[model samples]
Target: MMLHTALNWRYATKRMNGRRVPDATLERILDAAHLAPSSYGLQPYSIVVVDTPELRERCQPAMYHQPQVVEGSHLLVFATWESIGNAEVDQLMALIAEERGVEPASLESYRHTIAETVARLSTPEARHQWAARQAYLAMGMVLTAAAMERVDATPMEGFDPAALDEVLGLPERGLRSAVVVTLGYRDLETDWLAGLKKVRWPRDRVIVRAE
Candidate 1:
């Protein structure tokens, strides 16, 4: 019934009542994100959880003054590595090789192939964009996990990335904020979307099959 639970639980939460989400629930959401798939098994993203009132308050301006930024019990900021360098690729390959008991030389060759793939990227921006796309996959997983736990969430894309990066000290880690989600209990009174019916494209129109 896991799939049924997932399907029955998902919703784009509109408002949060500021009730604290338990650490256990939060960790479950993160575990779901950790299990998300990524390209080449190279997970190039990290989650930044902001639980402090002061930090969330400071983030409001960066989030275009979205009240949820300050009202939600927690802010999950998804960020991706700024650049894919040789050292990072080498590290991943080395782990894969060791786990598989492969020769270092063979691993080196594989690393070269990965490097070539990265080099073929049109620019650093393209590479970062690709990584950000992976981050979005993880974001989707976390959002669904939150919904499954009966937690409210708001996926936000309107924000000053530069300001958030500076505030979160992401540049120091060679990462940049790609997206954000606020999670907590919903404030039904103020959440206009809470009572509205959700609308989506018909399955026939959105999905195509070739036989």
Candidate 2:
């Protein structure tokens, strides 16, 4: 019920106070995102933490000059790998073996399964789309974690991706921005949304249970 309350209290904060989120609290939120599940447990996304004002200032134009982009304490850019093939599968298998204390050879069949899925994509675009979906799973975790921590978070997809990619040097890193979220404390005095009620589709209309 604590999570329920947190979700109810949180909103897509439009204005921020520029108060920095504590490092420990930020880490806990990031840790939750890291632990989010992905296909075959092969997480294909990376989070770029942008906490410096200068950097956020540079990112402002890319985000269409959203005030929160600069006023927020930090930005979390979730990016998907530009490629995911056999090599990525191999790395996942190796990490799994190391973490579970098993032989890499024992994971051969599982590795093949992951590789086969990647091979089935047939095109770079398809692979990128698949990876982007994985990135959004992590995004959900990030929003929930921020809510639980009582940190204002605003997930955004209003940016020019190509411009943002260039600004952040994402192509060189083999990543492309999938989504961005800004974190900070909401400004109660001036934010119009602060006093409004949270609106959503009623549960009965949104949820459908089928036999």
Candidate 3:
């Protein structure tokens, strides 16, 4: 019920007040993102939180000088792996083994299933696209959590990805920027979209039942 309320209350806030979300609330939102499901349980992405004014200023241009980029309390960059391969699968297998208290050898079959998916992707571009989808899942979680916390969040894909990646030096780390989110309280007086009704397709039209 709370989630439904929050979803209805939230919008892609265009302007944000200079109010900072509490550190505790920020943590919970991030935790929810981390718990987001990923293909093969391998989260092939990382979140870059830019809270410093200097950093936000540098990132603003990359994001086409979007007001929320620098106006919000923090900016979240969801960068997915540039590519996926056996190395990544091995690392995930190792983590699974350690966390589950099982030997790596025991998970060979499961690892092969993941590896097969990676192999089918073949090209780096294909793999990157898949990784980007996983990043979106995490971003969705962040949006939901922020809404529930009464924090305003704006998810934007209007930025130049190459510019943003360079601004954050993501390539060297084998990462590519997929999406971004800005978090803060909305500026009700200045945000024109504020106080406006939320619009959506009627459920019957949006959700089609399979015959």
Candidate 4:
């Protein structure tokens, strides 16, 4: 019920009042993104939290003049890895081993699964598309987390990925911008959609009953 209320209270906020989301709240929201599930436990994405005024200014034009890019306290650029390779999988496995206090080789099954992912996503196009889907999952988690924290967030896809990568210097890190989520407080009076009802298809229509 609380989640429902939170979801109902939220929207793709069109205008933010440029108020900063509290640091603690921002941490929780980001943790939710980190904890979001990903394919093959790779979690092959990076979130660039843009809090600097200069960077936000640079980002606005990249987002095609979207006000949220500049108005929000923080802009999360969900960029996924250009490609997942054996080296990447090995890094993740090593981290997992360190966290669990076990040898990386002990997780053979998991390694195999990730190896399969590397093989399947051999092509650049395949890897980019797969990485983007994982990036979307991260964004969805951030949206729900922000709603629960009573912070405003706007998930945006209408942006020049190439331009964003350039602005953020992501290409050098072997990442490409997949999507963005701007975090801030909504402008109560100015946001036109703030007063509108949340519209969606009926639950019965969307939810299939297999049984």
lDDT of each: 0.84, 0.91, 0.92, 0.90
After superposition, the stretches of candidate 4 with alpha carbons farther than 4 Å from their true spots are none
lDDT of 3: 0.92
Q: What lDDT tens digits, residue by residue, belong to model 3 across residues 23-111? A: 99999999999999999998999998989889999998899998988779999899988768899999999899999999999999999
Query: TM-score, each model?
Result: 0.91, 0.97, 0.97, 0.95
For candidate 1, the per-residue lDDT at 15 reads: 66
Residue-level lDDT tens digits of model 4 in 1-211:
9998999998999999989999999999999999999987788889989998799999888899988877889999898888689888888889999999998779989998889868888788888889889889888889999999999999999999999899989999998888899999999888999899889999899998998
Q: After superposition, how far is residue 145 of candidate 3 from its true place, in Å?
A: 0.4
Off by over 4 Å in 1: 1-5
Q: Cα RMSDs of all predictions?
A: 1.8, 1.0, 0.9, 1.3
Residues 178-203 of candidate 2: C-alpha lDDT, one tens digit per residue: 89999999999878999999999999
lDDT of 1 at 17: 79
Badly placed stretches (over 4 Å) of model 2 are: none
- For candidate 2, the TM-score is 0.97
Model 3 TM-score on a 0 to 1 scale: 0.97
